[model samples]
Target: MFHVFCLGFLCCSMVFGILLPVYESYKAVKTKDVRQYLRWMMYWIVFGLFMCAETFTDIFLGFWFPFYYEIKVAAVFWLLSPTTKGSSFLYRKFVHPAFEKREPEIDEMISQTKERGYNTIVNFGSRSVAYATQVILQTAVKCLKT
Candidate 1:
């Protein structure tokens, strides 16, 4: 019984994860349609995040509760169905708003970091090399004394 369920799950995952995406990618390439490609890309990214959240939810809440499986089924259906607009809802309500609010702050931080990051990395690398060389020379000196 468990094996049957596992097999079915594997099949479904393979179809959805590999076959469908490959088909869509081929279509996107053949048609040279940027919108179609972007739409699918956005859908997958949203769905991937949704799946991650769902996994954590299942781990924390699923074992103690009944009807979790049913809820997951419904949730998957909602996410996959274009009419439900689950991906769009998630992006507009959560992803877009959060990024929009932080965009200026994020851009400023990136610019500031870019200015300092090269010098920081060079300083750190040179310090690390100097320390390593000092340790090696000290070890060699100790070996000579012994």
Candidate 2:
């Protein structure tokens, strides 16, 4: 019962908090606006209702719907949830160009990446991890010898 409620809570939060924002970001790219609206408010209401469904499902039916209830139902509730395509499209089309706003830093990073590549960063991080692990092992071995 409580488990069902908890799952429902997770679903609602995922839908509202994570999914909605991502969707809005996508819409912003497609529509070129980041303004909040009736859609967001409606989703908030839907999340509340879904939470209620989770809490009372057991009471009503001795069964759990548990928020993966149905795509049709969720779609009806969500009424065209935001998709990621718009966002990626927006990033390539709009954002990449706007990073001109960070000209010097972007140029420096690109130059370093062209010169040294990702392997340099990865090799440095890996070397640090390996050195730390060896130091820890050597310390343990010394303590045992003592």
Candidate 3:
């Protein structure tokens, strides 16, 4: 059973990591279509977030539920199928609504952070590093003296 699971895992890794990218790249290059690329990106982003949520759900429900894997497989099918619009429904019902409410505040924070400028960030980072180095040196010296 363990060997079979390992083999299936390896096969999935190869298909997703290697074959899928190659196929997507070929399609992108052959079509030379920006919309296709954007659609692909959108699908992957939605799928990634869905996977995260699914993982947490699995962690919580898996031990007690014998049919968890079947449910997850069905969910993957629902999410990937355009006819179902699962991804769009999730985005519209959850993500978009949340972000819409916070958009103004997020934009304000971004502008404020940008206004601080590059030099300010550089100086802050340098100061932090110097402080850390000083602390480490003092600790070493104290250890040696002891």
The best candidate by TM-score is 1
| TM, every model | 0.61, 0.28, 0.52
Judging by lDDT against the true structure, name the best candidate: 1
Please write out the lDDT profile of model 1 over residues 1-146, one tens digit for every residue: 54454355446555664467568768987898997676566567677886788778857866665666556556555655568867567777887788789999999999999979988999999999999999999999999999
Q: In order, what lDDT does every prediction score?
A: 0.72, 0.58, 0.67
Per-residue lDDT of model 2, residues 59-134, tens digit only: 7643444444343235333433455333334445654467667889989989988778777888899999999999
Clashing pairs in 3: none
Candidate 3 C-alpha lDDT tens digits along 1-146 = 43454355446545653366458747976898886675455556566776677668757876666656555556655655568867566766876788789999999998988877776989999999999999999999999999
Note each model's CA RMSD in angstroms: 4.3, 14.0, 6.1
- In candidate 3, position 1 carries an lDDT of 49
Superior by lDDT: candidate 2 or candidate 3: 3
Q: List the residue pairs that clash in candidate 2.
A: none
- Quick one: how many clashes does candidate 1 have? 0
Report the Cα lDDT for residue 82, model 3.
61
